[model samples]
Target: MLHLRVVCPAERTEDVLRVLRAAPGATHLVLLRGAALDPVGDVVEAEIAREATDEVLSELCRLGVDHSGGITLETIDTALSDAADRAEEAAPGEGADAVVWEELIARTGEESRLSVTFQAFLTIACLLAAVGAVTNSAITVVGAMVVGPEFGPLAAVAVGLVGRRWDLVRRAAFALVAGFLLATGVTAAATVLAEGVGLFGPGVLDQGAQQVDFVFQVGPFSLIVAMLAGAAGMLAMTSAKSAALVGVFISVTTVPAAGFAAVAAVLGRWDLCGRSLAQLVVNMVGIVLAAWLVLVLRRSGSSVGGRGSRGGRATARREDNGRPLAKG
Candidate 1:
């Protein structure tokens, strides 16, 4: 379930209360008139089922409550009230399958931003992947995959496309491109340092025991695997089934391939570097394409189901052809 706190202007409090009372998925409504000091309005609180969050939020937005006052949403980790259970049962879809779009946009907005922490993780993951490639350590390669922050930007791109947010798409694209270039460049420089210390050699990457050597080899199968992983990753993200992400981390070779290419470049192995670069590019393209496709299908399916269901529009407008009914 989700908890919502709304500050409603005196004139609009009745409208807000009416919307909440009319929603079967809403429960435990509490009204504190003129209690808000910051926004100087009445405070209203309620608990709502996950399946109905979008629709309720859209109604509040349409009532001009968000603009006149404010609306805050939070997850209720544990709700002991029987009303909450009844509210969930009253909703149309499974809680886990529901998509809280406002929450998703907020989460991905933070993840897709090009911040220092994001750059640092990408750089470190690439460096670790580089070591794994040269040392033939599949374990380390998998570790790098798990540590890589590339998925945020990739998912941001997909989510942006689904939400029709061009600004998000541009920011995610910039972050991904700049991040990979930075990480690959830094990893290459680190390889030079490792060579000087006798820790890395040019032939280390060519060793027969290195299963990770395939990171530099591009094939049709690589694209297929990357695309599949991308789809699975998005599904896991949207459905809150995070445990499925471990498989996604291990299934794609993007980070490992980029690391291999970086190391090969520093060693003047242009042939290997070219192949690895191709592999990296192919994997990224495939993953982005697949993720976008998956999100599109999921969004479309949700829209269709929402429109056909009663007492559960899930934020869709009655006359907007499946668009959320938020007023400006």
Candidate 2:
């Protein structure tokens, strides 16, 4: 359920009230008047069910309440009285199946931006990746992948494409590019310094049998794994299965590839550097393609006359038909 708080001019109060009263899922209407302060006129409060939210919001938009006034809608977890009972009866399944794209964008937006938390995560992940490459340990590489904070911007790009929000798309793309360059630069400098101090050697960069596993190898399997991880990552972001997102992070090789490239460059291994760069490209392309596909599927399935919408309406209609008529 959502709690709608509307503040509008006193003159349009009747029109706003009519819109809310006629809305199919609106209940617990509370009207207040004469609270005008600083060009405000009146306020109206109501509780609305989730299924009817789209229609109610659309009506509000049509009424011009959003212009020259204010309308705030906040999700309410609990309520008291018969309205609460009705809300419980009308609630969507487990609250996980519903995809609130706006909310998802907000959450990921907070993560992907160059905030203190983002910088901290990137720094730690890059250091971990550099250490892993120096030691030639796949386990450390995997740990770096899991720790990297690049997934948020990547997912944001996909979501922006589907929603056609160019602002979000631009911001996400900028963040991704900037974050990668920053991480790579930092790791590369660290690698060079470590090598100068005799902590690492040219032997670490050699493509010999001893360090074969550290060499980047791009193949069809790499692309496939990246694509699968990207799709799962989007699902984890949108659905209730968010715990699986960490696994998705570990399954991809983006951060590790960048780290490998930086380290190889420091060790003067051009061949390994080239291969690592290719690996990074392949993984990013695969993940972006997969994320776009997921968004397309979600949009197609949620159209007004599509299966998901129809199913929601059918369920509501069935309940309406069997219920006793209430006095107005």
Candidate 3:
């Protein structure tokens, strides 16, 4: 269940109440007239089931409540009322499986942005991975993977593709391309600087790098593992069980591959560099494709045996089919 606090103008208060009344998921509706000082309107509050959040939010959005006032949502930790149970039962589908599209868009939107902090984490992770590759240290490589923040933008890309949000796709793509380029470039520069000193012995990478060769070897299992991790990542992100993300972070070789590629390029090992980059590409492509598929399924599940507040017209899924496919 979720708690919604709505600030509505006096003229629109009745309309907002009407929406709440119509929604089977809503219960314990409370209206505090003239309680909002900032917006100077009546404050309406209610608890709704997670399964019906998308539909209820959709209706509220259509009423222009968000534009005029605001809508805030919070998870309900506990609701002992029988009304709450009935509301959850009345909502279609299981709350855990429901896709609140608006919430997803908002969450991923922030993550997809190319921020300085994002660049710092990617660069640091890549540099850590480069060090791990040189020393053939599995523990260090795993640490680097955990530190990488690339998954946020990658997941955003998948969500954007499924939601048909071009703005999101563009931003996420830019973040990935620019972030990788910057991280790899910085790591390569650092490697050169380290080599200038006595930091690395001659042929140190060639001798000890075999242990980490899996980072560069691209094959069927590479894509398969990436796809599995991607699916899990999406499920962990979209579902309430976010703790599942712990394993997903280290399941792919994207960061390690980038780090290996950067170091290999600096060492003039063109073959290894190319292979490492291929591994990176394979992992990224597999993750995006798999995540997109999961989102499509979850989105469909949200609508089947459910309801949509201002549904889109049904249309074939096409890249150019910009018309919002009616989401349930």
- Where is model 3 more than 4 Å wrong at Cα? 301-328
- Estimate, for each residue in 60-161, the C-alpha lDDT of model 1 and write its tens digit: 766766557877788777999888899999987888877766666555656787889999998888998898878888899888888888887888788777
**Sort by lDDT, top down from the best:** 3, 1, 2
Name the best candidate (by lDDT).
Answer: 3
Q: Model 3, poorest ten-residue lDDT window? A: 311-320
lDDT of each: 0.78, 0.69, 0.82
- Per-residue lDDT of candidate 3, residues 269-291 (tens digit): 88989999999999999999999
For each candidate in turn, the TM-score is 0.88, 0.75, 0.89
Residue 291's lDDT within candidate 2 is 87
The clash numbers for all candidates, in the given order, read 1, 0, 1
Q: Which has the higher lDDT value, candidate number 1 or candidate number 3?
A: 3
| lDDT (Cα, 0-100) at 53 in candidate 2 | 53
Q: Locate the minimum summed-lDDT window of 10 residues in model 1.
A: 319-328
Q: Model 2 over residues 1-328: C-alpha lDDT tens digits?
A: 6678788888889988998888766788988887757457888988876555545555664566655466666777667778656654665443444454434545555544665677667767877877877776778887888898888888877866765555556767887777878888988888878888899677875544233243378899889999999999888776646789899888887888888888888778888789988988888888878988987885544432121333223323322344211100
> TM-score: which is higher, 1 or 2?
1
Off by over 4 Å in 1: 301-328
Cα TM-score of candidate 3: 0.89
